[model samples]
Target chain A: MALNFLIQLLVNGLIIGLLYGVVAMSFVLIYKSSQVVNFAQGEFLLVGAWACWWLLAKFAIPFYLAFLLTLIFMIIFGILVQIIILKPLIGEPIISIIMVTIGLSIFFQAIMNWMFGVFTEPFPTIFNTESIKIFGLNVQTAYLMSGLISIFIMISFALFFKKSRLGLAMRATAFDQQAAQSLGVSIKQVFAAAWAISAMVSAVAGVVFGIVNGISSGIAFMGIKVFPAVILGGLDSVLGAILGGLAIGLLEHIAHYVDVQFLNVGNLIRIAPFYALIIILMIKPYGFFGTKDIERV
Target chain B: MNLKNSRPCGDFRTSYFKDMSMFEDKKGFFLTCFGVFILSCSPLFLDSYLISLLIYIGFYAIAALGLNILVGFTGQISVGHAVFFGFGAFASAWLNNSFLIPVFFCIPLAAILTAFIGLLFGIPAARVKGLYLAIATLAAQFIMEDFFSRASWFTGGVDGASAEPLKIFGIFFDSDTKYFFIVLFWMVVSFIIATNILRTRDGRAFLAVRDHYLSAEMMGINLMKYRILSFGISSFFAGLGGALYGHYLNFVSIEEFNIQLSITFLAMIIIGGLGSIRGSMMGAAFMVLLPEIMDWLTRSLSGTSIDSALSLSEAIPFIKEASIGLVIILFLIFEPNGLAYRWGQIRAWFKLYPFSY
Candidate 1:
């Protein structure tokens, strides 16, 4: 029974980890292109989820269609955010840019709260069954679907970055902005594309998360919760993000399990990622996949 | 204006003491004294609500001063300052309640304790730089908030701890009017210390490290020591502010020191002007008053024809938040140096009013 429960927790962790991976990918995409750690990444997810849910529920649109429309809207929204808000802060201090994003996050949260009335809402039911037994263990159907969808998204993203021309340009730019600019990679367009892609990825994460857990302002916290994941995998690496997300996801579940079984404590599961972060930072400052920046100072 | 008191354009100082003095001249001295005179007396004339606002502003100014030291002066960005603030609140609350310590002694004791705790978290400053350090501080925020909220013995769990009314030497500061003066005294002291620190050797070293860590290191400035020292000092101020906040409110809760509060402090420092003592104070005052301004705006608009379409109450929080966000963005883009720079520009313009170029 204990073994089965452990397996179930492992499965649960993988599903949530995948969602975290998508959000972390969005973070890496923006951070890779522009050095700005967009604090609004979670807000992007929240906005996308809300948009999709609003379209589906309010307009009576189909799930897939609403999802696609939300993705497109998110892309435009992301591009506009970059062009309008971030573009002006091109040469500003990193702290200043970070503050802009922090401000943006607060603004986005308030907007969501104002529009959504500070209440959690269930997404229009897409999955037929509530729960499914997989190998004699009960699994949430929505979570399973979300897990599969996230995997599919991750695979496609992996291919897009590996083979696509725009992906190569983004990669080049991330590698060396000035060199890429000299090589005729329009740094401006690359930044726009990066932001667009990042938003789209976060939207997918948001939609899946909303579908599984319901839509709320709490969803935005995932953007922050995923930081440990990005740090674990290496801030700039795509694969690192995925692995880090999975690790954090698994760690959370395991932490909860341990808390329940051994410590009999409640909140330990919630803070597991932060604990993991401090430990990882102490042990490996650059993380598993992050570049070790050698400062002259 | 007296010739000795006024700093006329093109005037040269005859002595080093004249150049290095805190006030530019007697005019500055008189103006500051006038400002303090007004502030001290305002509580008597003002209503309780306005007095309370002043108290909160004073608390924020102290915290913002500390933040300015770490962020603006030392170039160490910390988003988890509210943790220290919260810690201080709980410390003072617990100390006053359990140990029967005087509120006067408890305040500085809480600050010192918070500074030591802050130094522990500042350990990562030696390893992490820039974004990493920010994230590290963020981890500190989440971890500490989690700990404080959960540690029922220390924090009283979610319900939190009640602060004893501040009583120093048989004097009861139970009312906002009384609390206002207490907070004002602390704010003034914090301001004096911040200014004096800037003029001191360690403070200059902080500036040097912030400007160019590599050069400062080459010049034998210990990065680790100063970085940690900066965190300690900043957290000390946060604690002092937090203690004042608790005593004035007569309660301490974990919720009061969440991420939003942290952002608000950052907003105070950023909008007021980074690295400037006066600017941080201005930022604190601006932020403390912002919610009231928003409420006033919302109240005036509530009865408008558009209220039916969009409830004003539902949108007020968003409007306030969005406006603050917009303010930070606008300030960053248009006036990154913040209100302090603008103040200096206006002063310069006035100094050369007729032929201002």
Candidate 2:
């Protein structure tokens, strides 16, 4: 029984970690390229989940189709947000751009509240299957499928960055905007593309999160949680984001299981990632896999 | 430098008085004093609701002034300022409820504790700058809020803690009119202190570091000392604002001091003009007053029942939040220098009227 509980906890933690990894990737992509930590990345997740639900419920679309449609919508939304709001303010100060994004996040939340009303909605599972027993441990099929899908996405992204033309362009832009622009790389287009890809990634992650925990305004707040992940992994490292997410997930779960007498381990579970974040910041500042040169002083 | 062009007037006494005067000229000084007198007595003629709204404006202005010190003058980005404000409110609330301390004492105590916390956090700030520092501060905000919500002893958990009405000299300040005077008095004191601080050497150091840290450091200024001092002073005033907010509401909650408040404070600084005292007050007043005015207008319109689809309250909240977002965006794109800069230009134009340049 103890072994079974342990397996169950491991499975749950990995699944949660995978979802965080996907969301953290969105943040990592934007931060890696633009050197701007997009605080509204979580809102993209929220919007994606809502869009997926609307597609399924209001339009009676199939699960897979709805997911694809939602991804496309998010990509377009991301690109437009960049072009309309972020692009013109490129030469301006960092605070202006940061505040603009903050404003955009608030605006998006207000719009979402207006459109969806402040009600939590349960997303329909893609595969209507029960928990699968593996070595006397019950694991939900949804968790397994979503976790695998997240891994698949991460692998594909890694491969794309390594080999693809657009990916190289993005890399070039991230390295030096002036050089990229001089080489006729269209820095604006790269930014737009980065935002689009990040938003789509955020959508998928949001759907996974919604499927597991249900959806509400709280889903959008996950963006803030992604901060600890991004910081831990190194703000500019994709693989680091994934590793950081999993580490946070595992740590929080283990902490919860330990159960200290004076403290409510369960309550601390929610803020565990942030606590880890504080410690990491105090020690490393730049994060585990991040470049030391990226450290600002 | 040429003395004639550098000096505003030929007479040494005239130039000295001009620089020494709060408004720089006879006309400007009187206009400002008149504006203050009108603002102070506004609560007498206004309704209770309006007076209460103005009191909130005063509170935000004070908080914004603190933020201006950090972001505007010190050239640091702080997304965690709400945490300091929250700390102040929580500390004061706990003290007021447990020991039954007067609001006056609680306010300063809260400010001092918050300044201490700010100084602690500012240590990391000595090694980091800009966005990295912002992230660290942002982490502090999350940690503080988590502690407030989870640790029930400090913040009374999610349900929030309530406090007794503010009392001065054993007299209860239950009425909005009474609270208005209390807030207004503090606001005036803060303005006076903030203005005077800017004229001092420490204030010049803040501006020096903000404009060019390396140059300031080269000139023998201690970066760590000045940076931390700015943070400490900024947090002190933020605590004052939070304490005042607690007194006004007679209640405090973890939800009240969130990232949203930080964003609103940032928006005020952005809109008001970062380094100027007048800019902070104007930014605070606009942010607080705009929403209240919008809500009032919504109520009046809804009373006539033009839109049957949505309730006024629901619509108002959405509009208020959206407008804040919109205002920040619009201001960033068009008026990044903020309202105070524009006000300065207008005043300059009038002062140099016949010359036109």
What is the C-alpha lDDT profile of model 1 across A2-32, one tens digit per residue?
7777888889898999899888988988998
By TM-score, the best candidate is 1
Q: What is the C-alpha lDDT of each candidate?
A: 0.89, 0.83
Kindly state the number of residue pairs that clash in model 1.
0
- For candidate 1, what is the DockQ-based docking class? medium
Q: What's the true lDDT of residue B45 in model 1?
A: 85
Window of ten residues with lowest summed lDDT in model 1 chain A = A288-297
Name model 1 segments beyond 4 Å from true: B1-6, B10-15
Which residue runs of candidate 2 sit more than 4 Å off their true CA positions?
A1-3, A259-262, A294-297, B1-22, B97-100, B150-154, B157-159, B300-306, B309-313, B349-355
Model 1: fraction of native contacts: 0.74
lDDT of each residue in B1-357, candidate 2, tens digit only: 677544352224546545655555566578878987997889768999888878888888888999999999999899988988888888888888888777678888988888998898888776777767777778778778878887688789988887667787788988899888888888888888887887778988999999999889889888999999999989988988888888778888889888889999999999999888889988988898878778778877875656455665667788899889989988988898999999988866765665764
